[model samples]
Target: MKRIVAAAAAALVLAAVAACFVYWDTVRSWLPQEVAAVLGAETEDGGGERDRSAVAVRLAPVELATALDRFETSAEVTAAEAVEITSEVAGRVETVLVEDGQRLEKGAPVIRFDDASEQAAVNAARAALAEAEAALGRSQFLFEKGVATEARLETDRAARSTARAELEAAQARLEDRRVRAPFAGEVGFVAVDEGAYLSPGQEIVRLKTTDDLRLRFDLPLEVAEQAAGIGALRLVSGPEGCRQARLLTVSPLGDPTSRTRRFEAALPDGCDLTPGAFITVAAVTGRCPEAVFVPHKAVERRGFESFVFRAEETDAGLKARRTLVKTGVLTGRRIEIREGLDEGDRVVAEGLQKIEDGAAIRPAGEEARR
Candidate 1:
């Protein structure tokens, strides 16, 4: 029994030693080669840093759209002219001649108020005028024949004048019952229908001239300065439809919160553009005689600072230098470089993550042209 136990113990010790060898080999492969060498494992490069390649900078013709000074504003489309059609007298709206969205001509009848009261008043005034004239004639005949006193004749003349004035007032009141279009425009918000009661001064319809439209937009202070030099503003539709408009008005005061200025352009003749449609406005502010522009994606931001990498071919090899650039206006994918880089400098547009200062680089896509 003692001899058998001694043999089993020896076998168990050998198995444990074999298991430890396998574990150490697996663990060594999982570690970084440099770390493994430091920990007494065999690795290449004598555990030194490994050299790698980074993205090279490219120089090419980048078509840049010179960003003009424009006030980036929020404005609504408005009619160049608008008038409110209201009921002049209090009465039931007997008939509405036009509906909402109807194009109307100047002096067109828009609404008609109940004219019964006005007509009655007119008739009453006529009767009173006739009575007064009859009295005046009778007094004149009696006075000429010396049968009436001059004081009585004067009284009769005054009554005749009073009656005539009332007649004119009644006639004017009758005209007020018929509402006429003050100007040519499209009818809007026709709230009253036939037989709807409307008080005096109640809104009947809004007439807005669509022949000319006015668009208003706000511009930031940065671009608002250019407005003084610009004679007009240009607006373009989403599909590149262009329209030129005269500078109608601009706000004298700037917004305290946004420091933005308000500007308006008048479309003298309204085209396919309608009120309330959003369109882009371009106003040339100032020009930079010599400026360098680059692809916007090439610039990276860290906090408030922006930076880019310039490719340099050193004696050792190709590498990059971190450069800080001041950016101006950004249009589409390109940004205007206000400072930091010269016009001939090359910048990395892609694979920026793999680049570091003094890191070796090789061009990946297009070849850099001088």
Candidate 2:
């Protein structure tokens, strides 16, 4: 019975040894080719040294490129000139000359008021002036013939002058009855109908000169100084794309409440943009001629510190050295490396998670593990 128990224990020990061998062989087969080669070399040399397989990574060389230092903000569209058309004198509207949404040129008639009384006054004044002129001519003839006094001739001349002034006043009144456009623009809703009596200073319609639209935006006080010398600005809308605009004016003062400065820009002509639409404004503050940039994926951030793995060639082979970097503006997929990097330095762009400081690296497109 003791021999049977011993035999069972021996069988159990043999089965455990075979299971351990199978598990180790499966793990070795699953290892990366480069790691397996290193381990095989160490095992064949009868060494118990730790594996020194390099981490495979892709590299990108730093290059100088143009970096646009710009500030983006929201802007509102406005007309270059907008005003509410009002009546200068009280009169009854005779004709509604312009319809809503009608485009008109400068001096085009927009509204016509009843001018019968004004025209009658003008005609009466003209008739009185004609009679005064005839009388003045007769007085001058009598004076030349020595039959009229100088005082008499002066009285006739004064009467003629008064009549002429009356006629001029009447004509001005007649002209005021007809409302004309102040400038070239598209008219908004007409507020009065024909035969409607309007009082002086009453709003008649709205006029907006929108051939060239203006964009107004506010920038924070800190960034206001950067936009001082910018010659042009860019406006971006969803799907409409980007349009160039000229900087028209900037407010000399900042708003105390919002701590922002107001800026205005003129949009290009022939664009189908309407006033009151919101758009994105981008103002280029400055440019860096020799800015060093790299793929954004190359940067690794741990807390507030940014790091990049640099591929350095040495006597042993290519190795990845972790480098600390200061980053600037990020434009699209590229990032500006302001410090701790130089032009032409190689950095690991991909496979960064598998690497550590001072680890061996086999760069992309290079053969390893013969």
Local distance difference test, per candidate? 0.75, 0.86
- The ten-residue window of minimal lDDT in model 2 covers 361-370
lDDT of 2: 0.86
In candidate 1, which residue pairs clash? 71-219, 73-218
Task: Give the C-alpha miss distance for residue 257 in model 1, angstroms.
Answer: 3.2
Q: How many clashes would you count in candidate 2? A: 0
Over 4 Å off, model 1: 1-50, 53-77, 87-89, 238-242, 270-273, 301-306, 311-324, 329-333, 355-370
Q: Write the per-residue lDDT of candidate 1 for residues 62-177, one digit (tens) a residue.
A: 33345543444445677888777777778888888998789988899987778898899999999999999999999999999999999999999999999999999998998888
Candidate 2 deviation (Cα RMSD): 8.1
TM-score of each: 0.71, 0.60
RMSD of each candidate? 9.8, 8.1
| Model 2 CA deviation exceeding 4 Å by range | 1-68, 142-147, 238-242, 287-370
lDDT of 2 at 270: 75
What is the model-wide C-alpha lDDT for candidate 1?
A: 0.75
